[model samples]
Target: MCTLLWQWFSEVELNSGELYLYHNSGTARRAINSNKIFGIGTPRYHFFNNLFWTESWWGNLCSDPPNWIGDYNVYVRRGESPLWDTQKNQAQAAGIDLHGRWAEGEISPYRDADEEDFRLMEKSPALDAGADAARLDGSPAGNTMACLFGIRLLRYGPGGSGRGPRRRDPGRLRARALRWPARE
Candidate 1:
């Protein structure tokens, strides 16, 4: 789950382990067997860039809501509602992913996720959709910009243009929580 990329056509289940960069056509479910993290009232799960066709069901009915970090992602469902419908209010209340959106099929960020080409297309909603992590710090050192794994690195500055690939580890993910501005 470090810097690689993919798209899925099935459900992603996180029963009692960690998953990264995997795609699933079904709901991502987590069992409620009383893990230390869940028992203590906070779950430190991190989900990024992955797509889901259904709700990220957490621990059936008995388990408490999960505390996870999710951002810079898209969620869409056909017909009446999305996978997160049942947990919509709860999830939002807990701030699961205030940044995610109910994207339409045509607005999908990927050029063709069905064909496994996950690159963001022109006018993609996902362009710069991630949290502006580098801007959190107010000092000169904190003024740096970052382009995380898999996404095209675009640098804009005086007489400057640079691009590269970078992976985000837990150490790098511990910065202050910030929300992306709302889109029109």
Candidate 2:
């Protein structure tokens, strides 16, 4: 079972769409059903975690995004209680030890998304202020969005055949039970 889960993890891709780890939000040992999210393409790992941010996402927003990417982004978020000159002021902090929130321990994909609603995306201005905000084309952003996503790594179950790492349903509260010591 552990081997299946491991194999699944090793094969997850980040180009399909919204990926999800089969099982509840707490189930650890599970599979990635690429057909669950949008159900268009084969249920494959398409999303990755966002590994770019200054402040910790766990503490700040407590979210897990697919594909940990580097985001040099800029977005327009409606500011509230404009105490500062800009609404994006306190909302855009960066560079935090997400390890404490996400990579700190084992977590089921379901629980992560359920708690946060899977709405974590990076923001960037797509354009500079002095770069002709009218028709000014925006610059490319590095992955600066602050989030930690858990992508569907593999798909192995009744739905797929040799499609992903073969893993049994680790069911709820099983994430902690999975004890596969790193192979020597």
Candidate 3:
């Protein structure tokens, strides 16, 4: 069983402003049991431009939070009907991932997940399928730096002004070059 985000509070804390933003991330599991992508937890969360792949019915277990918002994410489930995915449908019905998409036939969006090459394919739906991330925080989503597997990459905001190459591809890596730094 693999879980991504799990949060639990001993006491209820309403409107604590504990906002968590999960953007351009990927989570996958090979198990076929009832696995949870997100555990029941407090704190509002925003999910955007992510890829979730699982082989269980309980792909996402935390969708009851009123303040939790999600959009422009991809969901892939093994052996599930292409027309409908229960977890994605439930999230959409609850107004969480209104713009989320489901990958048919459990097709992986990554180039080679087995080898841990998470780069998106050339025709991947995740390419340019992301909404402007600024909408989540009402601030310009510029100058954001992400570290993937210890490789640091830069993401430019509006007008393509920042560091490194200008690529707006969605998902965590954003199709940037992977630099391996020497371990100390």
Candidate 4:
């Protein structure tokens, strides 16, 4: 978040009264956003992927949530919202609707692929890597290790610390734990 903010501050000229003062976004905020360093991209408009990511003239959080919740304690409070949400929602409630230039999915940072690129993905070998038709119907043809590993990788990604209360592994599958045999 700091990277983005710093980038904004550097790019956008602030006047004397508008000198960027670091302060919480609320009346009783204990502290400002979390100290997380949000990696920010350079100032450029990319229509394909980064279309939705842009800043407003008078910096708004909903436009870009600074802390991602860790830094914004209001989000943790009862019925309270993150400052970003508060900025957006309050503006909305006050009948001042703000709309971005691009919708969520349309404008992308990645280059807009031409017709050939779209066609190529369909003919890509990776999509056709399954074993000969026999295995498609659920019969065991071989280990198909690559496919199994890919599936597992997508499904069971480690979210947090590997060592702690929330640890998990392949052996501790939900079904296996439920069907575990009673103590002998």
Candidate of highest TM-score:
3
lDDT of every predicted structure (CA atoms): 0.42, 0.25, 0.46, 0.24
TM-score against truth, every candidate: 0.45, 0.19, 0.52, 0.16
Query: In candidate 2, residue 181 scores what lDDT?
Result: 15
| Candidate with best lDDT | 3
Please identify model 2 stretches exceeding 4 Å from their true place.
1-70, 81-124, 128-153, 158-184
Candidate 1, number of clashes: 4
For candidate 2, the lDDT comes to 0.25
Residue 134's lDDT in candidate 1: 44
Residue 16 lDDT, candidate 1, scale 0-100: 30
lDDT of 4 by residue, 1-184 (tens): 5655677667543211101111112222322322322333211111110111222212423333342111101111212324444454643443322221111223322222443232213322222221231222334454333221111112224673332223223111211001111122
State the lDDT at 87 in candidate 2. Answer: 17
Q: Write the per-residue lDDT of candidate 3 for residues 1-184, one digit (tens) a residue.
A: 2222333432433322222234444554531122223433332344555656655323334444233545666666656543345555656676766776666663776789789998776656566565553444344456354323222344458865354433222223232221111123
Query: Order of candidates by lDDT, top first?
Result: 3, 1, 2, 4
Tens-digit lDDT track for model 2 on 1-184? 4345445665555334334221111221111111122212332322111222222221111122222211222222122223222212222342211211222122222213457653322222121211111111132333222222334454556775535443323111111111111223
Residue-level error in angstroms, candidate 1, position 141: 7.4
Q: On a 0 to 100 scale, what is the lDDT of residue 41 in model 4?
A: 25
Q: Could you give candidate 1's per-residue lDDT for residues 1-184 as a string of tens digits?
A: 1112112412423233222321222223431112333233324345544444333334432345565555445554433444346655565777765766545453555568789886556655544454544432232343343323322234547754432223345334434333322344
TM-score of 1: 0.45
Predictions: Cα RMSD each = 13.7, 19.1, 12.5, 22.1
